[model samples]
Target chain A: MSVAGSDFAVRVEGLEKSFGHWPVLWDLDLTLDWGQLLVLFGANAVGKTTLLRILSTQARPDAGTLSVAGYDPVRTPNAVRRRIGVVGHQTCLYDDLTCRENLVYYGRLFGLTDIPRRVDEAISRVSLGHRADQRVRTLSNGMQKRASIARAILHRPPLLLLDEPEAGLDQESTVMLQGLLKEWAESGGAAIMTTHNVDLGLAWGETGKIGVLADGKVQVQEPGRYANVAEFRQVLSSSLVTRQRN
Target chain B: MVLVWKDILLEVRSRELVISVLVFGLLVAVVFNFALDVTPQRVTAIAPGILWVAFAFAATMAMSRAFVREREQGGLEGLLLSPVSRDAIFLGKALTNLLFMLLVEMVLLPVFAVLFGFSAMSFTLIGTIVLATLGFSLVGTLFSAIAAQTRSREIMLPVLFFPVILPVIIGAVEASTRAIGGETTVGLGRWLPLLAVFDALFLVICPWVFSFVVEE
Candidate 1:
């Protein structure tokens, strides 16, 4: 399907990833365009994080082609990595360093100049300016999550991948995070966030696409479209009942 | 280049690795002072071996902690996702570890001089320290990266590192011993070349091996 401004930020065709004998992502085909927010929904072990890792060039697909910003992730991972930022269950921040120090450290990793300014801007953007100098280990979970988000965006990568970014966040932090994500999308950055919160996903549905992944495949790709909320709830309930019976 | 500098800067701030290594090297030097007592004439003969053993043990201690900070805070994945070359990561980490090892040697040199009553400040001894520590850190950093990924990483680091780095330690200690003894024998010449060869071999191999260790 042709997306508006069809210049895709991330595109994968027949991407297959497996560990030993167990397949995690099987023949998965996905495309995400710039300026779009894509929320991927999947049950645990459905390959959501695996797909994100492969897209971010942190892991290689066993078969087929995957590209981020037109560079093949496996063959040209560094080039792909330059354009992608990832925040996963792993905060990927040094606990000994202050939040600002962590961002500055990552900024240098990206070979970014004007690191102080970039770090300052990211800290302000994440609304953690007051706590920038606090060690990451000392921060609360919500604060640490914000610091992680700041670090991920320090270089302003065009593509952002977040795996369960809202896992331990409070309601207020979740709202703030959602607002930041909306701003990032509005500013022409593409994001793919995985979450189990259907309500949060629905909040983003107006300007975002949704994919339901199950059993190592994208079972549905409904873009800016979801079945009626009540009907979806009913379907979900029946599926849970079926699972319980089995 | 940037990542390497970052690690160096971070090390400068914390100084944990360097301090631990320096203290450990001094402790080893003290222990060796009594364990390998020698006549004044033989003091120079045994100095290099003692220095290297101290440096290698201290370096391994520091290298194992290189990733501990990253692993504890989950920053390794962030590093792996960056555009930096894997070789740069390996070199940066190994160089920082080497720098800490050098710091340890710096402290040990004076202590050895005072304890053994023989100066180890000669240019040859200094050169040996530089070369030997490079070889030691190269192997230590690579094995430390591997150990960080496994269970019981603390215990596993030295267990895995000591066996694999036997050649480097032997080559380095032999070269240092020969240089200290003021013996320009052909065998001494062979040790220097052998130390250089091992350093070069590890420098080339560790970066490639590090990529596999960091891969998800």
Candidate 2:
């Protein structure tokens, strides 16, 4: 299910990041070629979000060569940003603005032409049309997740970084998110998502890849390595044990 | 342009920052009016200081609101994730806060004039307001971004904000005092330059600091 081309959409080598004196994401290496989804599995506070942030050009690595969409995040963040969309735990929607208004704001920021039309289409696509006019703060958690999905896909970026996109999502929303990721992958975009729910993350597809991060390092990663959820779980538990032992 | 418009539209839709701050500024003036009874002469003498103090306080409200809104909703990260340059984002936020404060000051000045029974409807006073407010908003926007990252942002913002902008407060009060006292030429020549220099310095520095801070 992986797209062709050795040309990677994202590349990181020996990436080292630390907050204060505590090291996170130590000597990490990751790569995503075009049209791939790498569901990064990790325990909480294991620097999955930090890795995504570095890839999204929101943070710099302490010691690493990081590139996104052919641009170094540190040297050419604007270019990297232009090629990416990120949805963290927070929906990133302005509480005061309606869903439509938030999309328009982002649409304008991305310089997307026909903003109103695009916003309408995005809202409707996310099944948020009924709540489009409601302030985002007033929306339910699931609805806000849908709104954030709309925002992320508004620009149709080449790379999407999602930290816990399924956190507040319902079953239906989860299915929608899967479909959205599938569509994005089909369209030659790459995504790196971090989630604690190994089952949902593994369910991305048989063609997708999974990486388990443990002890500040990506311990096990292979494309379509887990044929089923049981296999993924077995490896994950082993990794956790290894992490604890180390 | 998009950044500026987003902030303005957000403010217009919610009316949270401007309305609260305008009310706060007016309330400060009202409280001052009640606390001290003064003749028109005395009003002119002390009203500039009082008016600026009110504006300064109100501006902090707006500044904190602007940064808090971004931090609370993760809007800053959203903005950073966008293709827009950090400088553009900084300018947009600073300009929005500046516009918000200017609007509050505009509304408050008239109410202040009526309350204090004094006339400060001079172009010089308005210019001083613009310059001093530009400086205040510039510095406030930067500190707000910095403070927003801290746990105690409400306390952090004021602690970092006021001391840095004391020069602007002094320059604004001095300039407004002269303008309100009908000595516009002399006062503006002396104090407006100070305000202008302060404004110019931050207009360049704050955006740079904001770019650095947000990236961190």
Candidate 3:
């Protein structure tokens, strides 16, 4: 593994993906580094999930060179997969299993030997230790989402890709999730998350990077350039008004 | 190795697959009992075929649910995101399904023997059950994973499973019939080879095909 610089964790060049005849991602280029929390903001059908899936090795790119953790995702997906964790809309958990069981199941999948301790730590980290033995199907939507987060981070991969992690989450839950992301970034992990909530994207501070993806193209990339909270809010409101007008 | 055990442990607690397969197998056996009007001797002679049929249908039901349940809970993507090899996932699912199918077979065997008035305590019959169930579950597991991603997954599973496991079914039924009829080991020479061939083919093919099926 070659760490070209202290800042780079992912380098994607000319990444292109197509489903049948329709292209989903076209010549996409992005680079992420340590302690960076990047939010991909996009609306429906804009290829947010497709881009994340390709980056996570859940889908293949038709053309281009992409590298995550110094391994090419297209050619050596398994190596890239080892360094990344993804959370998508689907909870991807066994409903019949308990919260602890779900975490242990994934922990073992990643070949973590101290499974019981890891499961307990993850459950507590998600603040679900009280419901650890409860069946996942019995939990509330927010609780289930937390369980999904616990499973995704069980291996502590350097790169995290979350597809709409804030969708449908209430304010309190969203705040808690944001705090978790902040801590993860502080610990030198890089995160790329896609969200429909523009407010959540703007709330991420200096360590955060924001990208606007519309119609499969990254229209804007803002890295700590918003003047202040008020200015960020104004930009967000104006963007929404413009979109509504269009 | 850990993935396989994780699947098994989860199944042990939930017991969903086993319960479904057992109930379905019993229902099929009862319906067949009333549907077929034959003497005790004739029923004993045909018991192996009926047993295999029940297992085939019941195992398909259990196997399809193996991955579908994960997909519904959003666990499939998590598993895909893990560093585990795709082949390990395939093998883990197949082995877990095999374990569930075997559990169903163990419970069904005595009930089947009682229903047909055949002796249940035969090592040869148990061996045949093991071989047949393994082959059926392997094919069933792979097909279930493939069908789970389709639009009509519930309807697609049996459509995909049966056609592929036809040879295994034939071999299992033939081998089982010979064993139940008190035939010597010589009678299994042909069917056992066929079962082995099918098992080897599936163990090789399912892993390769699974990488494609799980890709979004």
Q: On DockQ, who's better, 1 or 2?
A: 2
Q: For all candidates, state DockQ relative to the true structure.
A: 0.59, 0.78, 0.62
For candidate 1, lDDT tens digit of each residue in B24-127? 78888888878887668878668767877777778778888777876776767888888988888888888777876787678777887787776666676677
By TM-score, the better pick of 1 and 3 is 3
Top candidate by TM-score: 2
Better of 2 and 3 by lDDT: 2
Question: Which of the CAPRI classes, incorrect, acceptable, medium or high, describes model 2?
Answer: medium
Worst 10 residues of 3 chain A by lDDT: A237-246
DockQ of 3: 0.62
Residue B30 miss distance in model 2 (angstroms): 3.4
The list of candidate 3 runs beyond 4 A from truth reads: A1-7, A223-246, B183-186
Whole-model lDDT, candidate 1?
0.78
Clashing pairs in 1: none
